[model samples]
Target: MVDRPIIFSAAMVRALLAGRKTQTRRLATSPLRRVEVGDRLYVRESMHLWSAGHDAEVTFAADDRSFQTGPNTGDIPDASLTAYFRMVDQSRAKGRRISRPSIHMPRWASRLTLIVEGVKVEPLQSITSRDAISEGIERAGGEWRCYDSSGTGCLGARESFCTLWSSLHEAPGQRWQDNPNVVALSFRVEHGNIDTLYPNLRSARA
Candidate 1:
């Protein structure tokens, strides 16, 4: 019944929002925070233009090309955002600087929940075509075995997946082909009255 926070790239976050992604893999580096069956993860999307907490409207200014009011900041528009504002505002008012990066987002701000169904530790290269598809790699056509002249499995499931992975994390060792071991987690979206699962509060304006 413990709640875990998982940070997802903006693209992955969108995929989850669209109900296209259901599985994810992570390095098994943190033994204390190891993921297990039945555990729930609150997805935190990477910082973007629309993540400004409690900031009712998008400042959408032309000069602010980076889309942040300042360093490490973005704005989000939602009614529930204000209630969260109060919680952090109290901290800020006492000189406790606000720092809510995507991964560090408060539990109350989470909009997506993933209930873990299974977990496995395996070599990263052991990922199969079926596993790649589960990891949200979409196929273009019937090119399951289509190979390039160089013998690379071009357009193949695992190939496409590796390409996608390299885009987000180029691997600390400088090459994705290094094939480090990872923990793969399969989860199901919990759909129902979320409010009953967690209470929502409206904070008073300061």
Candidate 2:
């Protein structure tokens, strides 16, 4: 194998940072398994975001002059993280097994945010929450039957919507399996900010 010297450019550095992505890691702060019917259970998870990869354009700016923007702040991809959380929740409901509950945001996702390159996904009407849940379940390799919270066939309550191949998954140890019911959880999602860790990456061109 040849020892190839790594080289970088300013444009490369700027390009890397020009775009971003976000991720979140959530844990069950309380005993989530005890969630019961008639209880308004919502998946609660802390969110963090960061740039997806080594692009010269990405830069980490701190609200304070000091480095480190605490947690949940940075070049994180907010939209992607939200999408990921929704995906995980959908999967869990469908009886799909999950280990971790952290969100994963990749570079390609950021690239797709643009209008030209981005996809045109219609906002799912709230009238299909059950369908969204069922679809999410099916994608996670679980059998699902559409029904509303009122126990009626098909969806009765709709809040949000999703599309095909636009979902996220748990990354092992994210969700508890023994209990298998995660209605509420808490954790932080961290996006990898190459600019923050190795600032030199931000100066690739220089």
lDDT of 1: 0.57
- The numbered model that scores best in lDDT is 1
**What TM-score would candidate 2 get against the native?**
0.16
**Model 2 residue 200 lDDT?**
39
Among the numbered candidates, top TM-score falls to 1
Q: List candidate 2 stretches off by more than 4 Å.
A: 1-118, 121-135, 138-144, 155-206
> Which residue pairs clash in candidate 1?
51-75, 52-74, 52-75, 52-76
Cα-lDDT of candidate 2 = 0.25
Error of 2 at 112 (Å): 19
Can you write out model 2's per-residue Cα lDDT over 14-123, one digit (the tens) per residue?
A: 22233311111112332323322222211111122332222112111211011222225454344334554444454446544222211222321221111111111222
In order, how many clashes per candidate? 4, 36
Give Cα distance to truth, residue 115, candidate 1, Å: 0.1
